[model samples]
Target chain A: MMSELHINLSESLKSKPASDALGFGKYFSDHMFIMDYSSEDGWHDARIIPYGPISLDPSAMVLHYGQEVFEGMKAYRTPLGEIAMFRPDMNLKRLNNSCERISIPQVDTEFVLEAIAQLVRIDQEWIPDGEENALYIRPFIIATEAALGVRASKQYMLMVILSPVGAYYPEGIHPVSIYVEEQYVRAVRGGTGEAKTSGNYASGIKAQEIAKTKGFSQVLWLDGKQHKYIEEVGSMNVFFKVNGEILTPALTGSILQGVTRDSVITLLREWGYTVVERVISIEELFEASRQGLLEEAFGTGTAAVISPIGSLSWGDKNTEISGGVTGELSQRLYDSITGIQRGKLADPFNWVYTVK
Target chain B: MMSELHINLSESLKSKPASDALGFGKYFSDHMFIMDYSSEDGWHDARIIPYGPISLDPSAMVLHYGQEVFEGMKAYRTPLGEIAMFRPDMNLKRLNNSCERISIPQVDTEFVLEAIAQLVRIDQEWIPDGEENALYIRPFIIATEAALGVRASKQYMLMVILSPVGAYYPEGIHPVSIYVEEQYVRAVRGGTGEAKTSGNYASGIKAQEIAKTKGFSQVLWLDGKQHKYIEEVGSMNVFFKVNGEILTPALTGSILQGVTRDSVITLLREWGYTVVERVISIEELFEASRQGLLEEAFGTGTAAVISPIGSLSWGDKNTEISGGVTGELSQRLYDSITGIQRGKLADPFNWVYTVK
Candidate 1:
């Protein structure tokens, strides 16, 4: 197996202690995993380099065309003082899917997992031990060719950078109010909505800023076709509890297939909950809220785990949901997921992969 | 006015005699104008730097989130060997509009013009002599902050890169085929379609590739809502000649307000053509094609002065336009615009501004 391939480590390494005040994505760990792919070279030259700036041509496609994709996952320092990642294989698969959609070469999943494991093992000292602190791993690929034409780049760079992240919510978790944006749509069918690409997130910044100005945590994106269906929250996959059943928007072509979103669905189903992935229109959500049938609503993602929605306001109309607090099911799901991540609870699905 | 900035020419700056091979955005010149903007200091340290690699943080927002905008214009070498720009103020105004939409700070229009003038004057040797070749200026702004969080960046870099571009068609202007993309939608209402952001072009790269694979020059993008209304053709604004009337899609908040589009409208109006900016649905276009009322269709942008559409393929249907050649009106409009730009005809509208 090529698993024993020598990893040329960068000489210029800057190591940081675990007790340092953790920020979101500012400071990086000493080493980063990199793998380059070309039409002839395929995938080769896998190495661990010091975290630093990347030199790019002024006409690199990523700078002008924004041809890039990224994945966000975390390596947790378990109660046993061992590093564990939650379903990293899912992230690898999803990253390949995104690459395929963008015409980028796909890396072998085994190679990616092994490389990530090696890097995390080397930087295990950077993973924090607190309740919410972990090593945030960002695996991203960018088109690196020095061409100005509007075509697929010949060369690409895939690198993984690790950042020590504190809790997404520094204080105790509180339900957040979201603004229902009727004006801006995040993704449309037959677009790059399903892919975790830079363009998708870049297009939503204006709407997100608008939502923040209107006293909301995030903007609930609607269907691009008619702006009627509840597509997703900007950075998270949305879930709704109606009639004592869990409901989420189906994996339509316009919505990202988030790994956390899928995990929640699987766990809820395994735990004896009616988890249905179907088109949940905004009208249905509002109507259910009016009838008190909507028990809870929350967004799920890697960042916040499960961020409960306290209320939703759209165009001067406001609706309170589930006593404006974390719902019973949401709390339970959060506990179960976090427990599995921290290696406190039994991972029945074998979702946690230990980094060796 | 701080117009006399330091010009640190790069060692790679070799004097290549201006050739007709300047094609669009290729073959950049020696020097580029650059200025930095920070939250503390609004905008300062304006200088002409050597065009070279830009070192960027791996997590820079522009590479990932695509917080970038750009403007495209050309400086023509007049018969008197003097450089002139066509409707530069319009480009500046449109750039500010793009900046406002993308949350980037707008620079002083006069200051930007002065900077461009200085750069053009310094690099006058790179400007081509023939009417077919001109110096294309690309003024772009990118978020340079090394943060990964989704927020407005406090630091930005604005630079104007100069490229000696040849004619769109060096041999001769030929009509091209375009594929009508019924599945993919480029922009929707209240989206960043009107703004010249990198995300907008990034989203179209996949569709462009598909169109190219199907033997088409570009993909005709449809509105995101219904996928019925014609929005644009690649990076250019589209126009249709239906029943002796020039029709273009109205600025419906989702289509780029192309400066070249506006100039064409004025030029056509002056030449006694009924130019109407209204919703031109795809159904009407197909119907007109069937009735032989569709005389010609063309795309307008800074890159290609006017690209004639010879044929359009939608789904399994194919329609020939104007006998697969540039139509009378298309040639007339092209001639008038190029004539005015190259100082071969009367400048009645005072559109050309000489850069002294």
Candidate 2:
């Protein structure tokens, strides 16, 4: 746990991308944080090195078996030109939970946090200077053991990379259309739906692509057990304001516990808005929309803090939500979170952690 | 597809392991088969190269999204010193089917077959001579693009590796005890369960590990939607001889279409055994077992052609089948399949394909 951290600067650093050209996950910083783990060494040799390729045996377990987990956070540049992060502790804890679910070894959260902060400070220039533009940090652990077996790996590698990303919505807070997926499922209640493992993501992409083809931005997955209960929309936790009460699917071990979703719930509760976490079936939601009770719908995730849902198409039935625009609640939640992240608003919740 | 294949022999070929010490997936051949695929060039540069590591960027799609598929087959040494493969064509076609499900580009089946055959012919000496010993061939494809978007990857790599493996049952062909998994669901209808994708395997492994802790050799999974219908046993297709009639769970999109299971059904049908595929619920199975109609049970997969199920433990209920010994049908199926694989019996269905 007390491994000495090493930094090896790149001989020739690459130039950062122009702020306007940055989209998401495309341009990376010069340096990355990495660590290795084995049964004997137990997570040793923490280092920050020049970003480059990682060679693995073709028979590595991560490639053959999807034994990998990742976390996404961002470093925001405040109005005073200082770097800040939002509830990184929550992300780190969730990462460990994901590792436990998939049998990956748990890492020291404090040490990993320190390493991440150090890495971000080293490449602070990559933090793009634009509203909503932040240096997106991706921390991932992969099973690096060189074996073809379908079991847990004896060796693992943790690497954290930084990318300068544009706003999730390029123009502004526009609404996203969603397709209710009935054919394919993301996860069941007793599956890796709650875990941030690669398998869950990989298995769910086909449905997302199908939605894209159907002119929708994301796929709203139903429960695997019955294809009735609303599980999630793409990689985000879904929410709806039916009869003026915010309702989201409960954490039933089949959906990712989104940090932003929790924050939204907290803020809504504080604002005297009724919030409920219970199983909401697709039938009930559509019927509510038909009766004009479904006031507003949205999705919450770390990547896109609040993605307002404009429409949901299930089979031949299509319903418009929030008048195909960002709802008032979606707007407020986004503003408050982004404001605190950029040091524009009062940090009463103490969610922001300044690195510089 | 007409690209000339490159051959790079190892500087010093590794020594072969002793027959008895050849564990599963432990010792690999000196060379491996590989091919590259990109959006511009669809699956080109087929080659046989020295077994080595594959360097990937930390942001490779396969690391984040489990966009990977694999196939398992074995090469057997005939009594006349000729090497043979069991239904390589079917395995290749199934690999394409899995690729289709995972959004991976399909490779030319004949070209890949030729590549695999060439590699096996080159490493023919590694094929063990023991009755149950053969070279286990693993063909896998993985997403190689270095991006973090949750869409299909533009770049992919396909590699094939061979390992000299001893018998799955090192001691003898014995019956296995299984724990019926009702807590964790593996797959549901309209999921990747039918495809040989890494996510399906990775998500299902936690249950397998739990069963291992309970001293069961494997996990018999029920359907994901309802924890009632019998689905599969570990990585194999399950079958029960109920009242002298062979029955297996139909391919209802959640159960893997095991290659060995199909062969077993074909052989049984040819031998005048009434083989039926339908939905079999756990309650029905238990009732049949109680009434002694479930005389024998077994699992079928490429690794263990026929793994007889001696006992099934579900919750507090445990029942023993076939007096805890290999059933007559199970023993005959194993003997018939292995005999044909080892070139000891006459090839009636023409499954044995000798490498040129």
Candidate 3:
């Protein structure tokens, strides 16, 4: 896959911010990766250039029709002074599925990995060197065709950008309040819910904002049809431990198959926990909470490996979980995932792909 | 509304192709309308700039969260050689509603129209003269804030680009084959379905492409829940003539309320026809077709004023309507709408908002 990635260094570089002060996606690296796609050439001309503004036609399909897909991962400066990525294969694999749903051409996984590894190695200085900090990697593809009609674009741009960031929780892994949203559904079966696309994020924003005004950090979405089943929490896949059995929504064509969700499930099963992937309706969850059997609840995503749920408000009722503190299971999962990511713990699953 | 607009003419104007060769949104006019918005200042800095590429940071919210909204309309060359816009206020009003749904800042309707008028006037030569050829107006607002968090953007850019488009159907208005889709859903209740945003269109492309491959010109979308009732056809509001009364899908919070759909309803009622807006299920439509009572079917949209549906394919069953030709009512509706648009007919309804 050595297609000779042309490198163009920036003549003037912006000063890198302190890793502790860096928020998510606030500061970018000096260099980034780009690959172009067209009907004739397909994906070609892979290059690494200075991070700057990307010029697009005003009528680009991505802006008008939203034919875009993205994935989120992280690059960490391991304890051994090596920069490594955590399960980038999972993110890229899911990205292909998202692209397929939108008719975007499938990317060469090996080629993309090669490009990402090279880019991360070149911008190794951006990777934060702390237990709570890492450089976030955002790989995205957008329809670049400047057309107005409702059709698939003949052109696309696959780009990879790196951002230095601190921990997702500024005050460490604390439980955040969640609003149980019944008015809006995140993604329904037979929709783009399982895919990592921009449209899904766009549609869920108003609900998220409303939840914020209600003193919640995120919104817990229900099923689109019945609005009875628990779908996901904010942008992460949710898990609930009721009566010592961990339960998460099954992949019913609508819930995103988060990498962190998959990792947590594997780790829980390995640790002799009964993890079940099935539909847990809202009524069942509320009943469990009422009976004081809801032992633990958390969300899993790339940004926040494990976000504990302290409270959940549904209409007039608000239920406090784990006594408004991080659950024991949630803390263990976050510690193990972050430890494995930073090479402080042994990678039994070989999930960490180190960059030379 | 009387704010002064700053104008920046292009140093080198790109030549436009012939009207016959001009397809939809392929080429742009010499000038375009631009505006900026922020949470602090609201929408301001209205200006007319040369049609060129727009530069956005890689972390723009529109690229990730997809907080974007747009409107589709046309600037017409009236019979008296005046450039007029048909119900543009309606389009802008709907755009505002869409922005509200997605949490984007709304632009002043009057100020936006003023900018559009000034830009269109400056690029007046780009407007086509024939009935089938007119300048397509695309007004869009995108989240320009450079951040990766899944929240509403603090900054936005509103731009209107003009494209000289030929007739929707180069030959003439004719009947199109439609595929009744049950596999994928476009929008669901309490979602972004009613909003004229990019996600709704992005989610529908795969279904649309599959329909095209199945030898159909458009895909008729059923409701997201249960996939029972008819929702829309190829991004257009659908109407069916059952027995003697006209039936269109009621606004169930999942169907886009189209401007053309409204105009058609008004014209039908004024002409003493029963236009009922109610839920039209697939079973009822098929039953009507079997009973020889399904008189006609057509889709109403801005792109194509009236597109007659000739044949409908549902699963293994196929039904031909109106003897596989354009119906009389469809032809009449098309004539009336186009006539009003071009000022060839009386403006008794005052639907067309003529630009001075």
Candidate 4:
């Protein structure tokens, strides 16, 4: 049985930003979902309260040890004037996986899902009505134990905050340039790379800043050991269409199992396309580009859904894929996935969850 | 030149605990040093304030991205009633190195040192008078921008908190058993292993937890790429003496450059011992143990100064080092370092910094 959820609504609401002016994660809704966890109490005091600053001890373990995990999902306003979520259960499950790796106690996924749904319902008007705009939900757990010891924290706080975001590609679907990072590695096997944790993102900031200076938007990471095989594109799982086959790097304990990546694979397989998951080296990819066999490449994630890769630069070599345009496959995947999410297309896979 | 520091003393201070009852990092002092940073003004607002909880926005990047770095040091009460710090300048310099890697802004070391001196001066009474008790200082910088973007935050908080800690070994310095961790990697060559960042420690907790369950006090980490070469012992740097030669892993971009490890190396070299810094494999160590050539091993860090290793368990093989007793070299080094730190021995190398 699900425990009771206490509600404390805010008396005053902040003015919402214009849908067109809403950038990514810039503004938060009026209310947020919060739950407390302790070794003795397990998890309790689930509630929705006014969004505000939190008071933490100076010696909180998360500030010193980085023992935290988070998940990202979106709540869309469907044409039927109802809110929809795309496979939020998968995100909660993945959050638990991250918690296990970070040594945090897990939460009941079903109960948390209900809490998220309730939060979205209370802040339903905050969902943007723009073409690609939606309410971005961020669920995170942080170690709150006020101790300086180097161990798992005894207390934690799990919170969910909502932000209405504008379109990833504000103008249109434009492919982005990617610099293949050689100096730094995102993660190695037996590391926290596969989890939706902050450390992985923190370490990638330097590489990302370097790529930005080089006029590229993101970096294509190679495997940590060999620095040969492709691991990921920025924070997204990468996919390539070579010769008529769809290929992506397998989940080898170093890259995130992206929810959109999984959905794309399922849709492709349902459409009679042969999809293969295995290690693909950068050299082979460049060789394919040289031979005109690399047709198109893109990254998959919840934020962008489908982000086309325009070009890749490794060492002294640069190759533009699909004439530096969004490929047919990339566009089709984006449209189909977004359509299903927004209730425009038939939900063949039953991937949409509606919030009452 | 240093900026003028503002000070706010607490009206009333809390009662102090008995020296013998003080455990490691269990109790904090009265005052703390804090400095704020913004892209617009750099690091400013340096002050000593009453130690208390800090208010942070729910979307502070540090809580979500783990963009933070920290340093650990101790202040000891000398036999002559003077407070002395061992190589504090080194800790401040290393903190800058960690800041650069984590993309946080650097603080003026001299200015920060003055701030620390002031805070320590205000809380000098909190430093315990027990045999092995002293004040432990933790200096950390955390991303404080209330934005949820993936990049580095535009604002940060650099603070130093003091904790009165007891001796690492309460009764005496006894050797500990270690398990060779082969499953989880602490860090890779291109990751944040060398930096004093929270992510490295966060990733190491699971392996340490596993080792503890098997009757080991710590886990000896191996290199990430091959998982064969030695890296670190728990959070400390490892050193081994075999066949009259000292061996420790080189500063190979994947292991922390420990201050204690450096001082020990200098001491050994000055005493006419040949210290080799190179990649030593676990296989070679096991082979030496089989041939009865392995003499002794220990881990070095600020907390313990010197932690002697009694035995090592690798897979199904367990070998006792120096008959599971503290080696003469380990004990001597501990005595020399702690003696110098406490102003009990001659400061030939001029390592101790006395806070006036």
Which tens-of-lDDT digit does each residue in B1-356 have in candidate 1? 65445667667667775485556566777888988899999777889877788888887878767788888898988887778898999999998998888888888888888898888888888887666788888888888888777777889988888888777655445789999998877777867888888777767877888898888989999888788889999888999999999999999998989888998999899889999999988888999999999999999988788989999988888899999999988888889888888777889999999988
Q: Write the per-residue lDDT of candidate 4 for residues B21-83, one digit (tens) a residue.
A: 887888899899999999999988888899999999999999999999999999988989998
Clashing pairs in 1: B22-B165, B22-B166, B23-B166
lDDT of 1 by residue, A1-356 (tens): 35544566667667575554676777788888888878788877888777778887777777777778889999998878888999999998999888877777888889888888889988888887677777889899989886665677888999898888876755535688999999877888877788888778877888889888878888999988888888888689999989989999999898999888988999889988999899888888888988989999989988778889999987767899889989998888889998998899999999999987
Q: What tens digits encode model 4's per-residue C-alpha lDDT throughout A22-138?
A: 878889999999999999999999999999999999999999999999999999988898899999999999999999999999999999999999999999999998778989999
Model 3 root-mean-square deviation: 1.0
Candidate 2's displacement at residue A273, Å, is 0.8
For candidate 3, lDDT tens digit of each residue in A1-356?
A: 66668888888877889867887788899999999999998899999999999999999999999999999999988778888899999888999999999889999987898899988888888887666788999999999998889999999999999998887878768899999999987888878998899999999999999888978899999999999989999999999989999999998999998899999999999999999998889888988999999989999998988999999888888899999999999999999999999888999999999997
Backbone clashes, each candidate:
3, 0, 0, 0
DockQ of 1: 0.65
How large is the C-alpha RMSD of every model relative to the true structure? Answer: 1.9, 1.3, 1.0, 1.0
iRMS values in order, in angstroms?
1.5, 1.1, 0.7, 0.7
- Residue-by-residue lDDT tens digits, candidate 2, A147-209: 766688899999999999987767656898899999898888777889998888888878888
Best by lDDT: 4
Error of 3 at B148 (Å): 0.6
Instruction: Write one digit per residue (lDDT tens) for candidate 2, span B1-356.
Output: 43578888888899899998777787889999999999998888888999988889888899998999999999999889899999999999999999988888988899899899999998998998677788999999999998877889999999999999987766567999999999988888877899898878778778888899989988999988889999999888999999989999999998888889989999999999999999999899999999989999999988888999999998999999999999999999999999998889999999999886
Query: TM-scores for chain A, candidates in order?
Result: 0.96, 0.98, 0.98, 0.99
For candidate 2, chain B by itself scores a TM value of 0.98
Error of 3 at B47 (Å): 0.7
Identify the runs in model 1 with alpha carbons over 4 angstroms from their true place.
Answer: A1-20, B169-172
Q: Supply the DockQ value of model 4.
A: 0.86
